[model samples]
Target: MINSHQALSDTVISNGYCVGCGACAVPEQSPFKILMDSYGQYRAHMDDSPVFGRTDSSYEELCPFSSSAPNEDDIAKQYYAETCEHHPQAGYYKGVYVGHVAEDEFRTRGSSGGMGTWVLHELLDKKRVDYVIHVRSETADKDLNNIPFKYQVSRTLDEVRLGGKSRYYPIELSQVLKTVRDQPGRYAVVGVPCFIKSVRLLQAQDPILAERIKYCVGLVCGHLKSAHYAESLAWQMGIPPSELEAIDFRIKDPSQPANRYSTYAKGPSGEKVVPTNNLFGADWGAGTFKYKACDFCDDVFAETADVVLGDAWLPEYVQDSDGTNVVITRNSDIQLLIENARNDGRLALDDLSIEKAVQSQDAGLRHRKISIGYRLHCEKEANAWVPTKRTKPSRTLNPRHEMKRQRLRTELRDLSHKSFLVAKKTGDLSVYTTAMTPVYNRYLIQKRSFLRRTYFLVKKTLKAMIGR
Candidate 1:
């Protein structure tokens, strides 16, 4: 016979089904709740705080980590169409990119352009929702990358501002579910694509969630990186992990150029200004540490979210670096609220087309189809079937196309070099320069000053004459 304690203790790396969403640790009031044990897996534990109770099971039912599930095909179809017509928030099916609004209340102060926090603030300040369930860091030392999370609501914008862009590491949904179970309040949630899907799945199983969850917001994600990335970044900045006090990923230094990403942190010695590109790539989608689970996600755009937000990546947007947010509204009320905010001059407005929006995240979108490969792999593993590689058709490769690719790479290499030389001349020994110093050291940094361009031009001339 299977022991009940054995089942409760099933949180493991391999055998356990923990998806690492932050649902379980949500309710600050739960008598018993979920926690990350020594093994890095979440298991339920007793928490008999008066705040924690067996209140409405709404968050529980909405939890994707819940054991019960509906038919996959049905769920997939609904998500693909993105219409829950029976719900109160109808008319949210996909269409031309909805109108855009940049709220002054949220713009400069938020993690990105501040839309994510703004939305949460609106829900709470306007009394649209009782609480906002979002991820916040539990660790003082962020170098470990594996910090626990807490799900709490910001009663005011100031409170929301306090938790801006922590992007706490190793957050899981099971924690949020436990929080909601114990804390009885209407809540809105913000998460990555998979986390949103899990919430939807939970709602299917639990009726209480259908009533409790007020809104869902999604962030654009290509992959989830490890703590080591942060540690490496700090180490590059000459601030070893041990000496660092606080780190802010998105540091806005208006004095600097727009594309130049600045990361700010405090250390035992003092404050440091480090460039962000070294910590994370400008194009995050292209890098490794793309989560393995993300490989199986088709909802890259957060098709299920009432509203989705991400960075607006485009040539025109290369400058104006306070960060412009790309937002998609699936809910009419939210859209109207934004419109009103814009009309009243409480926000800045920008009209963005869906085509352009998709282009910003092109690299990540390609992985949506690739997720099917992962799904198939999982099924094969479950069935103990051998996996076989399928032959892929080769496209006609023209040397001209290959040349274009090569030229782009060459240009990027040159640009990267230029950035380094600029940093060296400016005497800005930032994380951006240090982490990328090796590459620049090997190949000359692109000084972009008259000297480097002249050298390139001379090289091109020599190549042209040789061809003749």
Candidate 2:
């Protein structure tokens, strides 16, 4: 046990595979402590005392990044192998759906169609779960420097509603998972793909958690942004990280497309609302403030979860400003709940074909499943102890263009963190932007159409000749 603990500290933590899910810190009297670092991302720090054994979990078993830990396939096979249809991208699905909550302001209030909270609310209403453990704005905390969002226990529909929208901020499960263990009651947890995988890993070993955590509701993620992501966006809104009070990552715009949402930030003097695209780190693909662990992760649909919900980015659905949800259900109960809601006119939905479901997150799929091997190959070339992933290491990339793009993404990810720290130190946001501009410009250039590239090249040559 101690060796496994030490191994986790040395490999996953040291090698940058840790996503700070806090699963390792959940056990009582644990040697691991979850702390937010200077970069504004949560991480587990190991202490000297090898204290543990209260539950059937270990660092090796609980961490989603641990090579020894059971992969999503291993965990999902236990809960769903017998019943669900499996896909490389969708994981296990009993059904696929696309639409929004029609009954209330759920669609209007939420980041997407509001199926995330609607599902959590149904669990509470049906008495299926005594509490919904989800992320909420840190309004309850009096501390001025608190992270804007936190994992909290929501016991009522109203409480659940308070945590409605998607929070791209970093949050950990150590505190809330401990609450589940200390108190005895059914609970539903809301989190992204990797976090859900960690929960499934922990639940496999911890019977207490397995029994109490009634449902694992998942959010489809492009990738997780660090706490710095919030700071960067807020800072761009004239609310610097020091005075950063609160932020809303997704504010729907009816005039524009549903995907064309806005972000709102508040500070001491005032508040500002800006179109998300206007923000520096708004490009989800560029992956600013992204944890390196996210690049290695292949599960985009939250496969091991009971049900995974995310935006229906397909052309047919993107026009609706209210937003639509692409839901993949592995658990029969979740499928039944959503189906009943649709039948009763509570939810406006239609059966989404599996291919369309995959199409919604096309770019994310390419990044995770297609290009992941090159990332792993890079890790090996550096002789780093990379986490064992479903996607094996390979560099057999086609077209050469994709390889360059992947490399640029990795550069964007690493530089974003390092440059942000420099910016924070100097109190100049331009430090980060200056460092990122050329690389980001290169990334954009790589994505340019061939005709556009030719036009630019011709323009450059003509200008050079004119100068000569």
Winner by TM-score: 2
Worst 10 residues of 2 by lDDT: 139-148
Q: For model 2, what is the alpha-carbon lDDT of residue 8? A: 83
lDDT of 1 at 462: 100
lDDT of each: 0.53, 0.87
Q: Which stretches of candidate 1 lie over 4 Å from their true place?
A: 1-19, 22-105, 137-150, 166-168, 253-259, 279-290, 370-468
lDDT of 2 by residue, 1-468 (tens): 357678888999988888999989986667788898888888999887645453334668889888898888888899998998888877888899998899877887788899999999998998899999998877743531235688999888888877788888889999999899889999999999889988888787789999999899999989888889998998988988898887888888888998899988878988888999998868998889999999999989898899999999999989988899998898988888888888899999899888899999998998998899988998899988898899899966865567888889999999999999999999999999999999999988887753476698899999999999
TM-score, per-candidate, Cα-based: 0.64, 0.93
Native-referenced Cα lDDT, model 2: 0.87
Native-to-model Cα distance after best TM-score fit, residue 151 in candidate 2, in Å = 0.7
TM-score of 1: 0.64
